[model samples]
Target: MNRLFAATGFVPKKDIRGIILNRWGHAFVTPQPGFFFDTATRTAPRNTVMKGYGRISFGHAELEGFQHWGPAADQGRRAMTQALKNG
Candidate 1:
């Protein structure tokens, strides 16, 4: 499932990809990534300890589905991966 894709703003015409979790305990299944969508996740809330941080994959996430761009985004993902391997 394209969990990362769903994190971005991808309104599916049929089916959504998956769920996305933020720094908080909140879960999102639609477009919730971007600065306008979520800036709070960048900072901590209340008295929480910042013990660890995970650097997400360094690249832009693409929204794939019938509504956003179409299911062909899956093919592009595979092609990109293959190109990376070949190089």
Candidate 2:
């Protein structure tokens, strides 16, 4: 499966893991146990990580029970920043 995707020149080789291989030979990482409900708005609430629609993955410890996209993006950004800072 990975070989096939690599040969097709679909997704970059470095990202071909821990996700489902889709029909387009692309990696499809399932949402991290979250959901979305669109209010027809383009942007989600500030500090809320929104995947799509109303799906959210909250970031702050105070809002841990909520789902949001801000938290997810913020988390990734924080990790990258920390890694760079460390190096």
Candidate 3:
């Protein structure tokens, strides 16, 4: 799986596990917990992390409501900046 991505010049992290090997000899894996809404909901504890990361909902609405979605081609810039600063 990692080998295939590497062959195509896509370098994936090595320490990641729980990957699913498919029939096409491709590997699919979920992102690390807390990185996205779905995974974060499953992994984050109650009272520790706000529901939907304090957004009204997930997806486009949430992104727009939280100002995470930027105008035109600059989408995610604000969110990415916030993430980097917070990190």
Candidate 4:
């Protein structure tokens, strides 16, 4: 799926792996390394990497998680930032 399909209320496994396929027609069923949740908002059904989106995967409460679009992008950027800092 496109990054546009990711947002809050999205559980990484269900949202990112169910149907939305990549350009190569590949849907991932596995989580990346360091995939974890904040201890504060552990009140979700599954591994809730998205927390501020609607059923339509829009950023209704995106900033609530310090995330811009969704978990996919947010995590990607976070990792990039960490890598840059380390480099």
Full-model lDDT for every candidate: 0.38, 0.43, 0.39, 0.42
Off by over 4 Å in 4: 1-27, 30-69
For 12-73, candidate 4 gives per-residue lDDT tens digits of 67655456545633333343333444456454422353332233222222323433346657
* Model 3 Cα lDDT, one tens digit per residue, 1-87: 566667676556655555785654323223344433445335433222323353322222222223232431243454455455555
Off by over 4 Å in 2: 1-65
Ranking by lDDT: 2, 4, 3, 1
User: What's each prediction's TM-score?
Assistant: 0.21, 0.25, 0.21, 0.27
Our model 4 lands, by Cα RMSD against the true structure, at 18.2
User: Which candidate wins on TM-score?
Assistant: 4
Candidate closer to the true structure by lDDT (higher is better), 1 or 4: 4
Residue 33, model 4: Cα distance from true site in angstroms: 15
| Highest-scoring model, lDDT | 2
Scored by Cα lDDT, where does model 1 land?
Answer: 0.38
**RMSD (Cα, Å) of candidate 2?**
14.3
